[model samples]
Target: MKWPLSKKMETSLLACAIHKGEKLTNYCTDHNHLCCSKCVELNHRRCLQVTPLPLAATGKSTDFKNLSVSTENALSQLKYYETYQKDRMKSLKVSYKEHESLIVDGLRLEIMSFLLQCETSTVNRTHEHMQYTVIDMREKIKYLLADFEKSTIKEKKEELNLKQAPLKVVTNSCIRLHYELFHLHVAIPKVLDKPELSFIASTKCLENIQQSDIFIKENFSNKVFTVNGKSVHNVKMPSDSFTCDILAVCALPNGQVLVADRFNVKVKLLNQLYRVVSHLDVKQKQLGMCLITPSEVAVAGHDEVQFITVSHSQLAKGRKLKLQYRCCGIAHHQGDLYICSPTALYKFTLSGKLVCRLFEDTSADYTVWKCAVSPTGDRLYISSWYKHKLLTLARDGTLLATYTDPALLSPHGLHVTPAGQVLVCGWLSSTVLQVGWEGQSKLATLATMEDGVRWPRSVCYSSTTSSIIVGQWEDDTILVFRVE
Candidate 1:
């Protein structure tokens, strides 16, 4: 049935058959088509849920503002990958030139005269391969530029203003671009696949070239981390294991977890299955623990930092460095140790040399508790247990930003994922807050006490299993959650 045409319909151009001269007024849900009164009578007579076009537009479709923000964020990440690949290409070019020089230097005068033809052929092949890789990288850069252009300011503005914007189409296009960008990030490094170069006077040389393994793992959670089931996977330290407060937790690449018991002066290592594999006794009480290497760890507490080596689930004390003040929480990034005390942050070399006092917040309620460094080693995230806030700092210790929210109460432990998402344990709130790398946005409540996270004091993330481990202060139990 046709009603009086609305002002908009009257002013808009006709979108249906000329013979009927009818305006499209209804949307047929079953047939998925827009229809005029005559078309509906002829073709959609039996269709169910034939809704008026204006009524169909009443409900919200997609969040244009959030979409624009997400698109811009993805673009920024792509730009980071592009810059990284370009740096790799530069290094590859330098190495290629070095190898070429080595070949020329190694060729003797008489041997060069006899093997000139073979040398020229080998050099030409090597040079051609390098040039090919360079060209491939350039093409990848162009592709990323094109993808970024789609999310430009003008395009975003136009999309936001559209009355019937194709959100599904735009979303699908973005998903496809995200997949391609992730794979490109993995493949760009291998374009200049490392090739062994050697020079032989009489015989031909065989150079083995192997592409590095590529792993494309993308976290689309937007930091909305959560516990999957009614119960969190938790393991408690046995009575015989140790009687102490669990102050710090660190997850190793091999799926083992290292926990520092502050009162008992012990460090315990848990296997992949959350089983206690071994424990090490330290002379000083331990408050913080961090993995220095796959086989080594740095333990800090009571005004001293100790390095311990691990092998076959066994721990052996190696080196000890004395600090002027007590150490509470620790993190290692690029051969440097970041230690957080009650009032100050310190940076030190792995060899025990003091680097500099990064910063000190002497405010009565703003005690810095734990620290974590982003994978890029650019931003440092610290939890303020007393102040109930999270602080983001640059590598130079300059305060970048501070994050405080009602959900974030007495923040304790801090961990930054390789993806650059920041995770903070809210001790008083009994919840974990998943934050953005910039400390400007709170993504989600990663977990809560109801989910078996009780007074979580320490937190760590494992890339190997995509799991997060939480160590509680009062409780002896440790909780683990698998994240996507």
Candidate 2:
């Protein structure tokens, strides 16, 4: 029995096998043209062998099952390829969208840095358009794959009646073939390499901020601290063989003071008028110090604390306290000294008795340095130098909250104001930031390098004189800011 090629099949195969609305009826074996009569007359005029279509078809019966199986197998491979390409396209869409989200999030940080410096604009039109283009292509691919389900691949399956009792069937084979031949070779790279987004802000707003004093004050959140150049009190250390790098300072009730000259390993006593009275040399380099009592203070070195007292208008050394680990910062609260090492915080008595190792950070990158307790002694704040975080802990050293800000860079000194505000010295940024107890908000900046403060390593509030004293890293000058 012979099944003649239908008009639809002629239209489908016309581009390569049929001519002028005529179905291919004969196999011109000599010319290899399965052609209509017109094609035989025009191209195969000298052919020696010509077979009727049904006779040629009959000869191919033994291989019909093999031909159908091979075609189905090839289409099956195409189906798998098509599905993979479609999934990859969807993945690319999802991936690019995630990338766009991340890029915008990072841009938000950049925008925060530019807040006081410039004027910002809305999202870029070109960036949004490019993102939409990718989305549109993904939708188009989805619809195209769906439309392909009705094409020759599926139609051939039904025409051969192999859909139910499948002889190795393949699905969406045409869509797969189209993806490999066209989309993979042409579309993917362009979509992947499309320009993302770049945020641009104008700097003209800075001048407007300068001119409007009220706006400037309001923009910085009402607590704007300008440099009191005149109120800057300095105690010039004598030019001696020792490097007089003032790193820490504390004020006493009787108008006297203590200064930690770190490189020189000496703690200098200052008189009521910020004049140097006497210097007590220590065995190790003095880093952080706090007032333990009205007449005495405790200073921290690598692994020891030297208790010094102000007596007879001179600096006198008292009992030395040794610890198992190294000490970096010290804070005094309720007669107990809270000390910080590079990795842990410890509480010890005045007579060098260890209370407890309060907290140890073994989870992540720990760079715990300077620490301070709130006025109420309810919260302990620690500055992590490398992590760029200010950690607020409970009195017993339980972790409470972690604070981070773009303005906070290399935070070193930790000082909690009498009002429970945490003042931090951003060493690299050269700005002193006063934050809240919860580390949730920034209150104000007490001083910056514009106030002649250079590399401030330690900061302490003096309730006696109502002033905040700032000490530097390798410089001699100590800045005293009158906190209004």
Candidate 3:
């Protein structure tokens, strides 16, 4: 379990951490000294020689000769955590792009609505003015007509003996004619606006889909990329729907596909027709395996995972059993789920019963992002997101062999093909790796960056066609490699 960094090597990498009074300086200029000249004299009076930090950093002068298991584990943990965060950012980018269209559509509608309201206000004002003018004209006409009725035409004739006053009366017939043809005094709303809109739908919330491009900075699959490739199927989703980061993929016997959506905390089921017939939602910190079944699901929690029914109204509440510490992956064997962690993989039954517990070496810095059981269910292959190698462990936690070659860059997502080929994903560099049993032989290639397979998650083989179904994590697509 311990790394083989020699004492000589350890000493070469060591640098001094100096402390004086209450101050601490890391890798300072002075060798193993506590502080400045004054503090060194004060704190190192009882010790041996005090020198500059550069001297301690040198291979010959350092006090420590080797790195501990704990130190290596801490380093591995930090590296994977950074990688995980980076992947999240990539996912955010995809999500932002998906919302662009929706934003445009919503803005257009809002402008039209505003303009419609302005036209409606104009029409109301014009109608009010016309009504007042009509009312005033009618009142004047009525008064004149009444005055004419009170005095006869003869009286008017006598009063106007010197000058005949022409009789004038406003009639209903005149008013009717005026009302029949009227000019608009106020602007009527004719512009397109909210009120004029025949149909208007409220905008919905935007959903984002992104895949973080986090992997090893260096890559080495250039030579074997072609032989490993398969046909790509970018299983498309809706632009408006929320997208899930595909961390894991497994094919069912009926051609149904099971996906581990690490971010959305759900496991989805897709039939051969690509229909999502069933789904399970688990409310846990599922950075790795947010898995699913027909009626229930097993999800990874921080320290432990929960086995819960999919029918639960709330996701986190139905987690039937609290699992081991820091659960990362789930493997279904016979009647139990193997809970994977850095230090251990535990097996538990459906009713929250503890069936067995498998422990790995505590000293080894192993980070298991995904685990897969062999077809026979006797072997377990674990993929490391940070380590330089992959591990083959027995069901009872025995180390079968290690796969550490120069070809892989950040191994992740393990799967055992029905034909017994061990499949691994090269995270940073976009490659699918294959190895024979016992890590004795390489399967030439599976899929690589040159073949447009980047950051693949897992690979499944179909017996019907002898094709490899690869889940490309970063691209949010599936590439199927047919056996040629």
Winning candidate number (TM-score): 1
Local accuracy of candidate 1 as per-residue lDDT tens digits, 250-347: 88766787887765667888887877778887888777788888888898887999998888988789889988878888898889899898888899
Off by over 4 Å in 3: 1-229, 239-243, 273-281, 285-319, 363-366
Q: How many backbone clashes does candidate 3 have?
A: 20
- Alpha-carbon RMSD, each predicted model: 23.3, 32.0, 34.0
Candidate 3 residue lDDT tens string, 1-484 = 1334344422222312233233222222333222445565656655556545434434432111121222232233223434433433343334344444455446546655654564466546787775565456556645754555444434533544322111111122222222221100000111112211101000000000000111111111111223444455544444314445666666654355666565555566655654555666656645454334644455566766555443422233464556546777777755667777775667777665777776554555556656777644557877766775778887677878778766677777676654345777777767777776455446566666778777776666554344567765545567777653
User: Which ranges in model 2 have alpha carbons more than 4 Å from their true place?
Assistant: 1-230, 233-236, 362-366
Candidate number with the higher lDDT (2 or 3): 2
The best-first sequence of candidates by lDDT reads 1, 2, 3
Single out the weakest 10-residue window by summed lDDT for candidate 2: 195-204
Report the lDDT tens digits of candidate 2 across residue range 248-337. 788886667788988877888877667887888789988788888889888999899988989867988998888887898899887888
What residue pairs clash in candidate 2, if any at all? none
lDDT of each: 0.66, 0.64, 0.50
Best by lDDT: 1
